[model samples]
Target: MTKIAITGASGFVGQTLAKKLIETSPDAQLILADVHQPPNPTKSSNVECIAADLTEASACQSLVSRSPDAVYILHGIMSSGSEADLELGLKVNFDSVRNLLDTIRVERPATKVIFTSSCAVFGRAAVKDVASEADIVPYPESSYGTQKLMIEFLINDYSRKGLIDGRVVRLPTIFVRAGAPTAAASSFVSGIVREPLHGQESELPVDPNIGIWLSSPRTLAHNLVHAMNVPADKFGHFRTVLLPGYSATSGEILDALEKVAGKEVRSLVKEKRDENIQRVVLSWPAKYDTSRARGLGFTEDVGLEQTIKDFMEADK
Candidate 1:
């Protein structure tokens, strides 16, 4: 049986990924680790949930002790939260991850490591409406982005040295999460859809025309799983990939929401701009050339309308 370990398994994205893996890979055993005890929603013996504070060296070693064939590194502070607290961000997002890598290097050498990074790693200088694999150079504009970038380089170096087989997939803002708002700068992206659908007033922090790159949680899990089975040679010495996602403005996303739900539901969104949030959100590149990722067996979600419809169907 294929054994996979996923850190941050208590978070929304982590839980979604775990569910997806269980649905798609019945034979795969999973080790779900987090500071809070991760739930075994499936209640199957194949899935193991552990309470772990990964910042601790012992915790990292213990998680890696499972000797999984692959590891998905998904734990980190949200954008706005990290941006607000530099020391905390550095410790969790950067130092803790480095410790985890070290544990993997020693305990599970050459294991496949799929890390979920963010498009925020690309600031205004690295983008002009569109960013591609060839022309892009990351200069993170926020603490969260900076932390992610540092880990990206470490993963690349570790992979180059054959210490670990690493694949860094830079994620776009994930939308329509099935929970309350998070501390992320882009939480409003999902709030506008989720809150209204659940009969609550949603906040719009950016202009309607401000565009952002986005992916659905379901599609992201699929691509992350696909990343593991990809041949190490297919990475061709550079293991990082910008996961495929479509770009759309706030207005367009709300329009899709309206189409999926109704005008009354859409009208529940209340616009109240926050300059800091806008500045942070605007720095992220909304479009990418994901041909390289697609070539490596990655995939993207359909359109905004379909995404909204899917959320509606699932929320029911």
Candidate 2:
């Protein structure tokens, strides 16, 4: 049986990914690890849930003791929270990840590790130019981005040394996220669509013309699983792959919402730009040439309107 472990299994993406994995691989044994239990933990006998502090070395050791064949590393501090609290960010994002890596190296060397990174690793320079596989030289603009870059490098080094089979997928800002607002700097990207559709007023933290690189939660979850199935040889030298995404301005997203949900829903979005939010959002690149990920058989969302429609249908 394939044994897999997923950290941050309590979060939205983790929950979705767990479900997807269970559906696709019915016989696979899953160990879901997080500080708090997931809201709807999998009921399947093949799935096991472990609540523990990943920042603690003992907890990390225990989690890896199962010797999972593949581990999905998804835990991290959100962008705004990371920026606001550097110490906390360092502990959760960097320290915890290092602890996990070390534990895996000692206990389960050569195991496949799929890390969920973000486009925030790119900065203002990347924003101005369309980022590609060759162009992604990370000059992080935020504490969160810097931490992710450092982990990417660490994972790469570990992979090169044959300590682990690491696959780093740098995700775009996933939109139409379900649940309450998060401390993520990109939370507004989802809120602007989700809140209005739920008949709630949503705040717009950036200019209407400001564009962002985006993918739907469904697409990201699919790609995460795909990353696991791809052979290690597929990623020759660099294990990092920037996932494919579409670029849309705030105005375009609003227009799509209006077209699908009607003008009433669109009117609920309030223009209240926060400078801090703008600074972080603006630093992220709006466009990417993710042919590399596409070549690897990863998929992309059709358009912004379809993504909004899917969210409405799924949430309602």
Candidate 3:
């Protein structure tokens, strides 16, 4: 049977996307390539885990040996970590991608690739209201965003050469993120509200007025799946497009938190500004046009309140 391969299979987005693929595409097989195995094994026989360090040359080659029909590249370091650990970021985020793409060129040119990029690619918003798919001139202000945009362009160039079918979906900062937080700079966005609601004190890294492009994990998972299945003929060529998201200020996020968690729990969010975090957050697009994604059948979460409710319900 034809298989689907995914890197960063153990990550928040990767794990969620894997479960979604199993539930939605029962017949399709999945080969998970990550340095770590899935925390919870899939009940489906179609899911197989391949724990390998993608940054290593040999490991990447071994992964491509499976010859999957489609591949999902979801691995990357976060902004803070990338800045702190430049070497590690270069290895995992940059070199790993190059090695994997090289392996794909040699081993499986026919494999289609869906890359999960980020809205961080656009360093500044050109307009006050919304950005669009046409505004792809990446002015990445941080190491992580720069690397992601680099790979996105590489994928586009590879597609131009007819090497493989490549698609890039620029994901917004996902909210109500499940599980424990990792190194992501935007982790604090969810953390401030999520932790406080669970009776834990959380720190705010930026001001309440800091607006960002936001989406729910469920919507993010849907978009990743949609990217893989969208008819090739419908897209014209291998392209990169920013997905739709609700443009919400941090105060708006906290307001929703208060409604769901009550006054006492909501008050636990302690503010401590970090200039580094603020610098990064301020550069990102405050809004996006996203009409293209909507026209193409991609949808957004039902508003911030419902997203918070979904997070609470899922935690139960």
Candidate 4:
């Protein structure tokens, strides 16, 4: 059976990805782990759920002791959280990942590792409206983005050395995400819908015209699973792939919500801009030349209106 281990299995995306794997790879052994004990997404006996402090090398060693064929390194602090607490972000995002990589190198040599990164790695100043993986070195403005870039470099070197097979997929903002407001600067992208639906006020921290690249929970999960299944030989010297997503401005997203959920629900959204959040959010590239990733068979999102409609129907 193909054994898979997913760290940060408690988060929204983590839980969604786990469910996708269970549906597609039922016979595979699923190891769900997080600092907070993870609930099995499917509640299936075939899965193993464990609480792990990955910052502690011992916990990482134990997680890899089972020798998973593939590992999804999914845990990290959100953008604003990392920027607010430098030490904490470094510990959780950068240092812990390196610790996990070390353990994987020793115990599960050559195991495929699928890592989640963000589009925030590209600073607005460096990117000339559109970014492709080949043309630029990341110039991250936020601490969180810097941490992701650091980890990406490490993953690339690790893969190059043949220590492990790594695939780093940089993500666009995921909208209509199910859950409470997160520490992510991009959380507002989801909040425009999530809070409004629940009769809570949502804030628009950035200008309405600011563009955001986005995907749905369904698409992100599918692409992540596909990343693990890809042949290692298919990846070039660089291991990172920027996933495909369409760009829409903040006004466009709000309009989509109004179209799907009606004017009443949309009215709950309030404009309460915060400069720090805006600066951090603006650093991310709003559009990418995803031709490389598309050719590799990664999925793109449906339009914003359809995505919002799907969330409303499913969530209600």
Candidate 5:
């Protein structure tokens, strides 16, 4: 049986990915590792949930001791959290990742490592400036972005040295996230839509015209699983792939929501701009040319309207 290990299994993406894995690969052994127990742990006999402090070397070693065929490295501090607490960001985002890589190098060298990176790697750029596979010189502005870029470089180096088979996918802002507000600067992206639809007031922390590259939770989860399954040969030299996503401004998102849920829901979003959040959000590249990822069979959401509709249906 194929053994797959997923760190940060308690997070939204991890939980969804775990369920997807259980559905698609019932016989596969799934080792779910997180500091806290997964909110919705699977009942399947093939799945094992283990509480782990990824920042601790011993915990990382224990997580990889079983030599899983594939490992999904999904743990990290969010954007604003990292910016607010630089030391904790470095510890969790960089130090923990390094420890995990070291453990994998020593214990399971050939195991496939799928890492979830973010579009934050790109510095402030115009909406017309579309990032592509060839243009991945990360000029990160936030501490969180810096950590992700550093880890990406490390993953690439490790993969080059044949120490591990690493695949990094720089995810766009995942919207309609199911949960309360997170520490991420981009949390407003989801909050505006999610809260309003739930009959709650949501705050918009940036200008209505500020654009962002976005992906639905469903699409992001599918791409993560697809990244794990793709042949190593498909990635050639560079291991990083910028996943496909569409661009939409905050105004457009609200417009789509209004179209789907009605004008009242859109009116529930209150504008209270936070400079810190705006700075971080604006620094991210708002456009992308994910031709490489598309050719590699990574999926994209249909559009903002469909994505919002999907969120509504999923929540109901």
Candidate 6:
């Protein structure tokens, strides 16, 4: 069996990825590390859900003891939450990254570490037609982005030193995220559309003109698996490549919603501009030059219309 260790296994994306892994990768053993234990965890036969806070160095050290062939580090502080709690962000997002890397360096240096990064690492400056894996080295705008960028740099530096095998995949904002809305700045993107589509009211935290990159939950999960299994030589010139996503303006969101849910449900979405949310959303990259990733066998999103369809189907 191919043993894999994953942090944030209880999260929306994490849970979805875990379930899919269980169904598809039959020869894979999953080591699930999370803060709270998964309720009724016995349903999964191949998973070992361990309750441990990632902020603690000892917890991380002990968690990495499974000696898995690969590790998927999906844990990180959300953008809005990180901005709200500086101390927590520093300890969890920044410090935990260093601690986790150190643990792998000491105990499991041979294991490949697959990191889930974000497009938010790109700053306000507009790059070429589409941002490439090479463009992620620019200055980041937020503390959360800065933290991710710092970790990417550390991963690259450590890889060069032959400390560990690190691959960071910059994920686009995933739509139709399951569960309660959290502190992520991009949460509102799903919130505004998902809530209204299910015959409920939702608050649009930003204007309709705001443009951002997005992908479906299924695509996000598949991309994670792809990054883990893709040949190491495919990286070519750049180690970290910005994932390609459907570039949609907020206005396009409404159009897509109307097409999927009819005009009646579309009206349920209310526009209330929150400056804090708008600031973060506006700073993200509008598009990415993922030709390198595509040529290397990475996938692109199924467009915005299909993204809405996926959300609608999941809600049913």
Q: What is the per-residue lDDT of model 6 for residues 150-209, given as tens digits with 9 covering 90 to 100?
A: 888888877766677788888888886767888898898888788887678988888888
lDDT string, candidate 4, 1-316, tens digits = 9889999999998999999998998888899999989998795688999999999999999999988999999999988899899999999999999999988987888889999998888887655768888876688888998999999999999999999999999988888799888898888899988899888888898999988889888788899999997788788898999988899998998888888878999999998889987877677777889998888889887888888877878686
Per-candidate TM equals: 0.97, 0.97, 0.95, 0.97, 0.96, 0.94
Ranking by TM-score: 1, 2, 4, 5, 3, 6
Residues 1-120 of candidate 5: C-alpha lDDT, one tens digit per residue:
889999989898898899888878888899988898665456688888888998998998898887899999999999889989999999999999999998998888978999999888
Best by lDDT: 2
Provide the overall lDDT of each model, using Cα atoms, as 2-decimal numbers: 0.88, 0.89, 0.83, 0.89, 0.88, 0.80
Better of 2 and 6 by TM-score: 2
Clashing pairs for predicted structure model 3, backbone only: none
- Residue-level lDDT tens digits of model 3 in 110-146: 5789988888777664434367767546677778887
Query: Residue-wise lDDT of candidate 1 within 28-62, one digit each (tens)?
Result: 89999999999886756899999999889999988
| Better candidate by lDDT, 3 or 5 | 5
Query: What would you estimate as the lDDT of candidate 6?
Result: 0.80
Flag regions of model 3 displaced more than 4 Å.
125-129
Q: How far is candidate 6 from the true structure (C-alpha RMSD, Å)?
A: 1.9
> Candidate 4, 315: how far from true, in Å?
1.7
Cα distance off (Å), candidate 5, residue 227: 0.2
| Model 1 spans > 4 angstroms off | none
